[model samples]
Target: MESPNNKRKRVKPILRCSTNEQSERSPDDQLAIIKAMADARDWEVLDPIRLEGRSGSLHATMDWAVEQVIAANRAGEDIDDAIVYDQSRMGRTGGFAFGTHKQQLAAAGIGFISVDCPIEGPHADFIQFANAEAARAQAISIAASSARSSQISLERGLRGHSTQAPYGLDRLYLNAQGEELFIIRKLADGTSLRLDPRTGAELERYPKGVRAYRKGGLETATLCIGSEEHRQVVIRIYRLRHEHGWRGVRIARELNDAGIPSPRGRHWTKDTVDGILMNEVYLGFAYARRYTDAIYFRHQDKAPERLEGPGGRKVRGYRPREDWFRVEYPKLTEYLPSKLRDAAARWQAAYWDRYEDGHVRSPERGQKRLHALSGILIEETTGQPMSATQSGTRANPKTYYLLPGSHQYSSQESFLRRRIPSAPLYRAIIDEIEMLVCDDDGLRDILRTEILKAEAERRAGDGEAESLRARYEKLGRKMESQIDLLGEDDDDVMRRKVEQTKAQRRAVMERLAEIDQGPRLTADQTDELVEQLIEALQSELAAFAAAGRPAFRKLTEMLIASAVADLRSGTVSIEFAVPASMIQHRFMGMDRPCEPKWRTHTHKWKSLPLAAITVELPERCDMDCWEPFEPKGCDDCRRQRRTA
Candidate 1:
């Protein structure tokens, strides 16, 4: 018995606030204002959809709320209108995104209303367009102002805003009088520990809360060496590189093996070690204005146009070296001495020279010929994977799997050291695989043994999968809590922590998905699968043989996991890629099964003996010694050698 004119319009109110907006209204404040307006207008407001700590410039962030409202309207929920505190709250992406969203809402029979900018009647569209353009202009102005402030800070030798201190260093805050206040040390748990500079006493522990740390007014910050433990690690890393000429990969391996934690408290990687080595911060210098925000045109041939707002395809481009602002910190010299700094520079130069030379002289530099066992072929002596190399003339090419470091040593020293001819090794391995696959009884026995092994492993992984699931849920809650607590004035550090947590959660989710998707075939299923595989393999093997080397390469890659060759000892050890059960499961038109723990079996082939595998010389040579191949010379000669 309700009249149409007096009937309340059902609407959902949307609220948004980004972390960068310092004076912007909070979601709660916006909701209160919206509710007051809705009450006065006699509109029925649903529970508000809040977008906290999400950027207004991104359409993706607002798309979810828009879609939900539209979906509800289409499902006969009687959503008459979608209301927001303001048009900018919906998006600052100019007319393109904001106007497009408005059109979408209208098409779904839902009116879009901005409470603050109420433009009804004939000129409503024009007024809304103007407001959106104004919002975009404001965003650009704010970005420019931020850039100018950062430039001024860099020029004045004060630490640039929100810049985190590099690894092995801590941020030291100074008062206006240039006196040290306290040093902040970031911990592995994303929390920070503050220390008294003079006494090294713990000041306080800053929890991972709304703010990363409470910033004081008129304070400047600088980098200083961290704890004694970290200082020693840094010194050792420098010494390893400068004195011993160790590469980043070798350094990373050594650190990982020693159980030394990386900068992020994870396992050390070559890139991580290299980043530490290449950082100029270790040598008493801080650089700023190293990068600039840029928007690239999709078509390179077309002239670029000025696109307002963050909707454009944005990118970070490196600024010119001359434009960079460099600030010197004499205090850093105490940590890394002048002598050590010079040594590091020398080491870097030598390292790059070696890197470039190796690339230029690489045996498989330009060729695309497939080497079946490229990654899995290991040299027994060094435990390093051998790279596919091509020697001899282009007309008569000789392919081999040569262990790395051949470039570091002379041709004479690298002649037959840790090297195996591809032809003989490939023939031997393929022949063995053929014999095993062709024999029905042998294949069935292999499948039975593998199925039992796989079942046992699957049972073991259940416990691990459970643990991962628990961790994944915990991480999800942690991320949600962090997001909820984020304030409008929260700095980059807090945002980064949230992002890192999200990344960790994503990784855990992916691992759990893998565990879930892994095949858990039963005994009967395994027997039926084996029969199908034998029939499929017989047909496939014939096609593969007829197709030539490319097909052979594919077959080898599928069947083999790894092989270790001791060239001097004339022995080859092979590890199959997967269990016979999983191989059957894969060929039966299903997802590839998880790799099983391969057991290496050594084979001494009669057809291809040590004499055939090893490089043979037409004439005898005087150097018959069996010492490890050194780049400079044998150990005796190397020890006696002098450097200028």
Candidate 2:
């Protein structure tokens, strides 16, 4: 029998590639080279760990591979060595970090080895340190070169290397001869428009979530006016700020209600709106180098020589305004007039003054009241959630749940056009619940129908689940076969094919996992679940009269999934949270039940007439009630408000 110490040493190989650059050797090539070296030394190589598109400067990036080797050594599996394709792959953070990581492996009784730069004997430490310093120098050189190129591009009146265009702007690519190649229009809906450069004709419209075409070699990009629709929207945003003095949040709300998609193809937010308002790009100026590189590696070390500014404070990374590179684009000037731009600037300054003087307060400030239907309430027209807002003084507050932009319609005569009073709406919803509980036969019939429907849907999905399982297995085998075909002389094409197969296998695995996790039930189980839910609901109802607001809120959270308000139809549709089929399974497992798959029941509430509500206005106002007040009131009212 062979002696234990004489047996081939078991080693763990680590392979890494910092970027997807074609010139850089791939992790697969590195692994293959490391394995060949291991075989030559008669070493038993364990499954290699691969990391791609990860920076070598960050020790945290290699922590997963390091921990595994250390763990195996501690568990008596005896990982004799931790080997890497090259010393730079260990780290590019100079001698200190590299040496520290090596020491950590040594402490764990695992020897560190680099296939490319194998150092041994007394000079090993010095040689390793030199190699690490070289890597650090190379990293710094590359960063400095990139920064220089960007500065040169800016100086030449180009837009630098940034590919992203702000909202209401398009990137026009120009060839070396200064002839327009194509215009890339990135819209607020996460879609791109490819236009003919000269005629501005629509060449193609890419679907949402598809990335826009990148500029090629010998091509430069400049900002230009985007689509007419987007330009009008931008003008309206400035108009709303300058003429109406509307805040960013209110503007975002208005845009959302009008079915205008926000930048990034998502709902409008306060930050997104404010960013557009503050951007100088719309004012015919493109600014770069507005922020310092405080987060850059050179500044991260906190070395005295590398730090900028006084007192060693970073000033939150904002560079001086004078230091910023400002280039004027005549094309952008036509997008927004100078008059509107100046008016917007003045309005912004005055708004800040009002905020500092305590005349303006955010809607969420100092409000502690809990809204029972806050998240669950939805506006049917937009399918957007209703947000809670309060008016009046702190002592006598009146809360309402309404579509965010509907505040502009507060003075409308129709009840549905305005806000929904929280107290009255909550009362109406509880009344509906009580009526349902009182009729046992009706509730039972509804529950039975919902359970049967769920069973039928589940039965129909069985075939699909089986098909997914078979597909997942096939993908798994395909990936394994491709991986086995990989060799020392394999080309880039074969390697890419293997990677694609791996990605497909991962997608199929995720789908199979989702299907397997869904709750499964039979016909017998469904009836028992329905009865259990009715009993629970009845118990909840018995205590409803005496239940506090907190108790009632909790009950609603558990029982109601969502409530949609149809303003035009004057109806509120409700979907219960715990479907009759899922109640027993959820209750037993303590899992949160999924939303009901059946159609929701609609309930109509009595509308509180606008004429009934009296309003008290200032003495300067001639209006008897709020109903007659236009969104923009008369000149006298405006002057009076300004004077106050």
Candidate 3:
């Protein structure tokens, strides 16, 4: 036997949600529960329901939903009431605010009805006050939970634990041999274990020979200098932001235009560039809690209601820097000096152009060397690195490459002696690079052969994972279908069915998650990618023979680790990062000294490529002195004295 009713009360369903409340059941589901109750009570649910956004108080969306009931009645749609799944969805802002909205709805004769929120009948006023308190309690709980998680993550950063290595830094070498590194697995007794790559047996002690486990490179990670091919892009990004005073968006655009790959293998964006700029990890100081509140885009028209103010596109609440936990790595510190890094940060923050900009055109004109040799040139006199700067106004700029020095170097080289016309020197070095690439095929051969092969081997393992992903997608569709077939009833049989479907879905999801940890590229895919690269390089080689900057900056960074003008020797030392052990000293044998003619009348100087300079040969390649020269890096302690 079933009870029947003739009159169906026309009602509108309303739901409000905060952007952070992802764990809450969806609005549609909540509406379905409301609809089920409505149907039982012989109520007619209207079209065009309202679902709004909130963290706590969102006045506009709720205001629009309330007005809609009045408008519908005026238009002869005769909306009798506005129903909410829960009364708390009405407002947790304040009891007064909640009561005011309730009064307005009552005055409109569109009685406010809450379906599952059980305080709608007798003692409704008491229940309403209690509901408001509960809503406040819920918001406090969510905020408290969020703060706790953030504190934990921030604390981990302070303890020198990182989810990822900083931009322009990776590969924690095992020892001075620089045989890469790995996750140091420790037993319960605190014994560090490294499984032998060949034997799979646990070593009693940390092995000196082991490297990180990779599909192809079980022996080593990619060796990098500050100008390492892929890594140099990051170096370029840092320079663009700090040294040149370019905004993150501009930097990202430049990188995108140059076809440089982002960390996640996509086009760069301002947000990503901003992350790198703010990332303390680059300075070898770990910091967290910069991003606590996540961002979401609120679509226009699709937005629940008109926003109250000038915002809705992006929402983020930042924690103060003092509240952040930071850890400093004394040994791992590299790249920019602390003084320069700090100054750059302050300058960027102080900049008005960074805030309200289409763009402030680069101070210098022409295709500037925002890559490779931007920070590579060193002055022999004061042991200083050349920096990029512009002398003339933005409209007609005269870019100068200045060799600014440390306190000691500053005392040595007078201010007037540091500035040099950048264009001629930059053009000359680029010409020299073109000459080297035109004549020698050492780097090209490596990229086309060994590098491509390594890439292929690494990617070969992704086929199974791809197949698993396909299976997972199909499995998801089947689960959705099974769910759709189930009735909306909450009886024990339906509940059991729901539980079974959930368990099945979870098992499949667990397997999918497991596969996510595996590789996503195949060797076949890599081979195709490599073939495309080879074609591009071959086509571009002939064009590079003409006098111009090379298309690929990574290749330039690879061939020339650094360029130094040795004024005393009348030679510019261009150190090449050739992989050959015997070739290091042999390149000096082909030395030919020549004076470089300068466009400026201020100084008379001679320069020659380092490849063309003569030096006393080392007996063999010493891994100890293999790293690129740093101001106070390992090269200083090398017992081998340079005989020029």
Best by TM-score: 1
The digit string of per-residue lDDT tens for model 3 on 245-264 reads 89876787677667776665
Better of 2 and 3 by TM-score: 2
lDDT for every model?
0.62, 0.62, 0.48
Relative to the true structure, candidate 2 reaches a TM of 0.40
lDDT of 2 by residue, 1-644 (tens): 01131335678887877763311357778888888997787676777767766677655665556766664554335466888989988867678777877888876557888998877889999999999989877876765555555566666655542447788888987888888889988765556789997888999998654455756555677889887888888898888887788988789778877878877666676788888887777877755655443212221111212333321112234444445556777777767877898886665556334323222122234334447777567877778778788786787566667776453332232344446656555655555565565456667777767656644543336477678768878978887887787785765777899879766765655444333233455455556666776776667766654454556665565566557776665556665544332353333533224523221100001111101111121222122322221111112344234433
TM-score of 3: 0.33
- Candidates ranked by lDDT: 1, 2, 3
Per residue, candidate 1 scores C-alpha lDDT tens digits across 253-281 of 77867778888787666787888887667
Q: Rank the candidates by TM-score, best first.
A: 1, 2, 3
What residue runs in model 1 are displaced by over 4 Å at the alpha carbon?
1-86, 104-124, 160-162, 188-193, 204-219, 227-277, 294-315, 334-644
- As for TM-score, the candidate ahead, 1 or 2, is 1
lDDT: worst 10-residue window of model 1 = 599-608
Give TM per candidate. Answer: 0.41, 0.40, 0.33
The alpha-carbon lDDT assigned to residue 461 of candidate 3 equals 51
